[model samples]
Target: MLRELKILLLLIIVVGIIYWGVEPLAHSIMHPKVAPADYEFKDLDKIDLSKGDAQKGKKLVTENCTACHGIKAEKINPPMDNASSASSYGVVPPDLSNIAAVLDHNFLANFIKNPVKATELSHKFGDSNPYPMPGYDWMSDDEISDIVAYLASIASKNLSDKDVFTQACDRCHSIRYDKMVALTPDADLERYLGTKAPDLSMMIRSRGPKELSVFINNPQKMIPNTPMPRVGLTQQAEKQVISYLEKVGDSKKAQRDSLGIKIMIFFAVMALLAYAWKRKIWSDLH
Candidate 1:
C-alpha cells in the first residue's frame, strides 16, 4: 500500500513538472521581452492643451483638413471619394470624429506636427518618399492646441466597442470575420509597416489576451524591428478594442469554457472509479 501511494505521488510530480515546462516556462523563453501596456504619451511635448479653444480649432480644421480628411460629428466631409482618395494617397484618411477621445493627447499634438516622426515611421519614409500627411509645423502652437481641443469637444466619450476598434485599428489591420477590410491598401500598408498587417479576426484566440494587450500597447517592445508603432490608445479605448476583438474572434468562449468544466468532472470521476477497481482487484494479494 505504501509503495502504491509513492507511485501515485511520483506521477503527480511528473505531471506538474510537464505542465510547468510546457506552459509558463516555455512562454517565458518565447516572449522574454513581454511588458505591461503603456497608455501615456511621453514622446514629444508641444503647446498646452488646457488653454485651447474649440471654435478656433474648428475653423482651423475646416481650413486645413477637410480637403483630405473628414469630421463626421461636425458634418465635415472629405472633398474626394474613397477610390479617388486611395488612388491619390495610397490609403483612405479616416474620419476624425473620435480620435481625440481615444488617442493620447500629447501624441495627437505631436502627430499633427510631424506624422512620420510621431508614428515612428520616419525610417519607412524618406526624402524622396515623403509621408502622405503633410506636417502642420508651420501652424502656431496655439493653433495646433485649438485643433486638438476642437476634436476633443466634438468626440463622443461613450463609443461602442466596434467604434473604438475601428478608430484605433481598422485602418491598418482588417477584421475579415466581421466583413471589415482595412482602409489602407495592402501594398501601402506593406510600405508603411514593412509587412501587411494581419487580420484580427482570430488574433485573440491565436495570441491570447495577455500577449495581445502588451503588443497593442507598444509593438516595438516585443518586436524590436517591427514597423508597427505604438498606437497610444487610452486605457479605456484599448480595453474596448480588445473586447471587440474577443467578440469577433472568440464568440463561443463562454460555451467552450462551460463544456470544458463538464469534461473535467467526467474525467475526474472516471479516474476515481478506475483507482477503486484497481484496489479491489488487488485486495486478495494484500
Candidate 2:
C-alpha cells in the first residue's frame, strides 16, 4: 500500500509538471488559424460628403430602421419582450440614439449595405437571422449617404456613457461596476452566444482603438474561432463605446496616477530620515 501510494504521488507530480511545461505550447497549437482579413470599408474614401442629406436619411430611417429600433427613450424597439427576436438574432436589436457619436460613417455605411457580409460570419448559423437586415445595394450612393446622415443626426451631446453602454453592449455583456467585476459566466455565455464573451470593463485598457477597430470590423480574421460577431457599429460608435469603457473600467486610473507622485515623494523623505537616524546611532557607537 505504501509503495502504491508513492507511485500515485509521483504520477500526480509528473502530470502536473508536464502540464505546466507543455500547456502554453499545446494551447498555441490548438488555436484556430484565422483566415486573412477581407473585411473593409467599401467606397468610404470615395464618398462625396456633399451628397449626404440628413432629411432624406430621416425618411429612410422611418421606412427601414424603425421596425427594430426606436429613437426615443420612452419607446422600446420591437414593442414586446419577444423571445423570437432573441431566438433568431441571439440578442434584441439595440436603440439608435447617439449612434452617430459612437460609429464612424464608413463602417455604418458598409454594415448598412449588408450585415452578414460585413460581419463575415456563416449566414446559415442558427443564431444569425434567416432574413437579416436588407441590403440597399440597389440604392444610389447618395441615398445610402443620406441614410447614414439620418442615423448620425440622432446623437445627443447630453447622452451619458451608461446610455452608450445600453445601446451598444448591454445585450451580450454585463459588468458590475459596483462589485468591480464582470458578471457573465462562461457556460451561460457559450450557450447564448456560442462562445464566452469577455467582460468589456477592462478591454480598452488592454486593447487600443486601432486594434479594436480591426477586431470589431471582423472578429474572425483577428482571432479565429472567436464567437463574437461583428457588432457592425460605425467608427464613431466604436470610439464612444471605448470612451465609455475607459470611464467605467479605469475611472480611477487618472486619480491614482496623480496620487502616485505624492506617494513617491513621501517615501523618499521617509527614507532620508531613516538614513539620518541610522548615521546618528552609528556615530554614537563608533
* Every candidate's lDDT: 0.84, 0.65
* Best-fitting candidate, scored by lDDT: 1
Q: What global local distance difference test value does model 2 have? A: 0.65
Worst 10 residues of 1 by lDDT: 38-47
TM-score against truth, every candidate: 0.89, 0.64
lDDT of model 1 at position 11:
99
**Top TM-score prediction, candidate number:** 1
What clash pairs does model 2 have?
A: 102-236, 102-237, 102-238, 103-234, 103-235, 103-236, 103-237, 104-234, 104-235, 104-236
**Residue-by-residue lDDT tens digits, candidate 1, 1-286:** 8998899999999999889767788878887956577666556665588889999999999899988898889887878876677768866787899999889887888889888777777666779988789999998888999999999999998899999999888878899999999888787767655577898899999888888888887777777757776677878888888899989999999899999999999999999999899989999778
**Lowest summed lDDT window (length 10), candidate 2:** 178-187
Candidate 2 TM-score, true structure as reference: 0.64
